[model samples]
Target: MDGRKSLGNHFEGVAARYLTSRGIRILERNVYNRGGEIDLIGQENDTLVFFEVRYRGEGSLATPAESVTFPKQRRLLKAASYYLHRHGLWNCNSRIDVVAISPGTVKKYRVQWIKNAIQAGF
Candidate 1:
């Protein structure tokens, strides 16, 4: 993988570990459909979470959260819908989240977890 992609993937792993440590059960990763992709699928308490993990190197063109444009939100919502329907969980309560990761010096990492990131559905 290229540097950026490899970094993003690594951040996803880190984010997953963080979430799991917080009592969330990971359901899937890098799930794709006609609409687009979801970085992570997890459950917290009684809620289903569709996580979008954004990783940025130094001097990023856009902030990790800002990278998720409106169109991107639509695609994410569609993918989440497909996931719910495919899993026969149409009635299941779901929410979107943003896991922003920024690499730091000295092997440190900065992470921000934003819950209810976007409104889901068509």
Candidate 2:
């Protein structure tokens, strides 16, 4: 893979590890289709979460969460819908989540988990 993609995968790993430590069971990663892509798929309690992992290094203007704009949100919703239909998970409760990561001075990285970051059909 290229440098940017490799870095993204690394951050996704970081996000996954962080979430796993907090009791979320990761089911899959890099889930992609014609619609779009989901960085991570995991279970949190009874909720099926579709995570969009975003990472912004130091000096970046926008925070990781801010990078997920309106267009990005629409694409994520489409991808999440495809995922649910493909897995026959229509009856299951699900939500789109954002894992925002950034470099921190004290800690190596700062991680923020935003639940229900995007709603379907929005």
Best by TM-score: 2
Candidate 1 stretches greater than 4 Å from native: 1-4, 105-107
lDDT of 2 by residue, 21-117 (tens): 9999999999999779999999999999999999998889999999999999989999999888888999999999999999987899999999999
Residue 59 in candidate 1, Cα distance off native in Å: 1.1
State TM-scores per candidate.
0.88, 0.96
In terms of lDDT, the best-performing candidate is 2
Error of 1 at 18 (Å): 1.1
For model 1, where is the 10-residue window of minimal lDDT? 101-110
- What C-alpha lDDT, on a 0 to 100 scale, does residue 21 get in candidate 1? 89
Give Cα-based local distance difference scores for all models. Answer: 0.87, 0.93
Backbone clashes in each candidate structure, one number apiece? 0, 0
Could you give me the TM-score of model 2 versus the true structure?
0.96
